[model samples]
Target: MGTLFGTDGIRGRVNQYPMTPEMALRIGKTAAVFFRDKTSHKHPKIVIGRDTRLSGGMIESALVSGLCSQGADTYLADVLPTPGVAHLTTHLAADAGIVVSASHNPFYDNGIKFFNSRGFKLSDALENDMELWILDDHKKPPVIEDKAIGKIFPVSDAGMIYSNFLLNALPPDIKTRIGGMKIVLDCSNGATSTIAPNLFSRLGVEVIPLSTSPDGININDACGSQYPETLAKKVLASGSDIGFAFDGDGDRLIAVDETGNILTGDQLIAIFARFYHQHHLMENQTVVTTVMSNMGLGKALSDMQVTHLKTTVGDRYVMEQMVASGAHLGGEDSGHIIFLDAHTTGDGILAALQFLRVLVSENTVASQLANVMTVFPQILMNVTVNAKPAISDIKGLPEAITIIEKQLGDTGRVLIRYSGTQPMCRIMVEASTKTEATHFCGQLTEIIKIQIGT
Candidate 1:
């Protein structure tokens, strides 16, 4: 067997090798053993949560069985967001938390990710140990005796607890300020379908919810953050002040302004960074973003006298840098924004609330607020590859990238890297114009294809 974990977690098509019930069970057992051995608690507890996926029930049952068999009690937060699970883990003081959802992927795919006691994703070292144990026949989990066996129970108030936490994160006067503001929400028929709609309604917003009904197979079916065009149309048609689209697991968010223009995560971050700086809320006068962020965002941050720190792709790396630098804001261009003072992981609903707070407090509209930073034209291309070779080993790829970088000079930038969660290489270019960005991006894609494409 190969490594069971990826950048996010163990993910694959449902019923496939890594996503199968057997593998989920083994993962649960191995994770229980690992956590139990690491903690001083004699009987550790694990919390499991999942999105509205057809395979979620099957995977959740297997995980519960394996965890119980290993004498680890389990609490089930059924159909909750990824960030909700992370929050519940720390709230309930569980030893660990597991989320069963492949994020923004199609419904046919599933995944499992672990969060430590502190409500953060498990470190690579811990995941590696669990992976080794999963494949170790000699270390197979031994079923506990009858008296020591663990029990599983439902967390009836999980949603309420998480919702209250999110509400409290906002200013006390938020409801009064946002009252009667027409807002559209696209929940992607996944975890936030209920939570987001109810939360917004309670906050006195005129909420027009889309894709709030999840029938297992409809999650992320051309309606989530991955496809904001539908939401954009809805926002314009409904005459809403703003719109927010969340991924299947509610860890990412993409916004649609009133004019039906979709705002990239970079634009959102830039807006918030300036707001935070003006309000003296930004710690260390810095914000963190992934390498995939637009160069325009960096330029904007510099103009605002705020430092910009770039981390490797992935919210985990962004969070790591934030914690090290004491930055209160960090996120990816893919819409995974992390508000360290608010929540541990990327909570789409929480981020949306923060954005709304900024708008209400500033007494401004989405389009005007979004104009705080000028977004340069960016084009990204992904090329399938047969192998994962080091960038240095890719003949002519470096020279090609260097030439493009020098040609673009200070007005543009180029980034060529392999996707951490997929079998593809991503070539991203940002230039002064759409034509320049697209033309150069196409050239780089061809170079990558010839050097390493499948």
Candidate 2:
């Protein structure tokens, strides 16, 4: 009875202890029962989508078996992005949406995340209920009666439905403004392969789509948001107006300007925040970001007279903080943006659309999008370390942090975090210049290695 769910969902190496087919089956059954709403006149329906993982099929079958066993109908949207599943769940008025993906994690990892009927992620209380049900061996949902077994159905038009929804959500003027916009899209060879190109083409933008394969292992290997260097090169070589890359689940997005400059989540958020504020669309004049956000973001927001709030590292945490604060925009530095007015979760496609909306409204180039923020030069280094080191309890870690803080003063920032999913420590530094940032980050990393025995 170990904890199966991670920061996002139940993610781990496929065929491993927590991610095994048997566990997936139990999770499906537990979710089916948990989401069973007797008040509804119709039967409960759950939409499930997966990434291009090689193990996707095996896990999908197990999930379907469990859901059907509990009298819950399941719709199989094979190889769709996580955000697409979230959108469809709300569009179809289903009881819930389930996404099978490991997001930016490697091909060997897989997971199951879900959205409740409100088109939002399951709350912590709900997650705890399901976990308890899954762990209690002797306590199970009542076995389905003979005539109540559920059925599995294939959603053959999921892609088309999602594409249509995206197009319809945009203003007609957007197409005319974007007609000559040259853009390159890296689909990460995952879920967006089914929808992004179609969405962009409908908007009358010139779209050059790369890495749009369904090959599971190849996805995000050297492409996608995690590795924007390749996309930056492609943008430079093609002389494209700009480039956007999506992670395996298509909920995170990273971009490169025409000049081959990679823009991170904070920069992108700054662009949107400024645009929304100008148009008076930014509700409450606040933006939510994770603690991992660069200090430059706070400074920029402050200069703009916009309040910025920080939450935990995960996008879910950001969303929770946003909703509680009644904020209109929130996201993580990893490119998980939530335009709460439009969608319920972090959607790469939606974020791209918002960026385009701003670009068209401002009538400016991509490079100028975040010009006001002048992103501080930042460097990050991750080192694999032993499992469960006393990172917070390290003897000299606090002293080292104090030293870095004093050095940074008001012009820079430093952050050291433990990898949520791996045995690693991530050290990040930001300064006025790249050389300074790199040097500072290197010294701090050396200190960590010596102190933590990494």
Off by over 4 Å in 2: 37-42, 443-454
lDDT computed for candidate 1: 0.91
Query: How close is each model in CA RMSD to the real structure?
Result: 1.7, 2.1
Query: lDDT scores for all predictions?
Result: 0.91, 0.84
* Residue 37, model 2: Cα distance from true site in angstroms: 5.6
lDDT of 1 at 4: 77
Q: Candidate 2, residues 275-379: lDDT per residue as tens digits?
A: 888889886999999988878788889998999999877788888888999998989889999988877889898888878877887888899886867777889
lDDT of 1 at 222: 90
Estimate the lDDT of model 2: 0.84
Least well predicted 10-residue stretch by lDDT in candidate 1? 1-10
Q: Name the regions of candidate 1 deviating beyond 4 angstroms.
A: 450-454
lDDT by residue for model 1 over 116-182, one digit each (tens)? Answer: 9999997778778888999899997776889997889899999999999999998888767987999
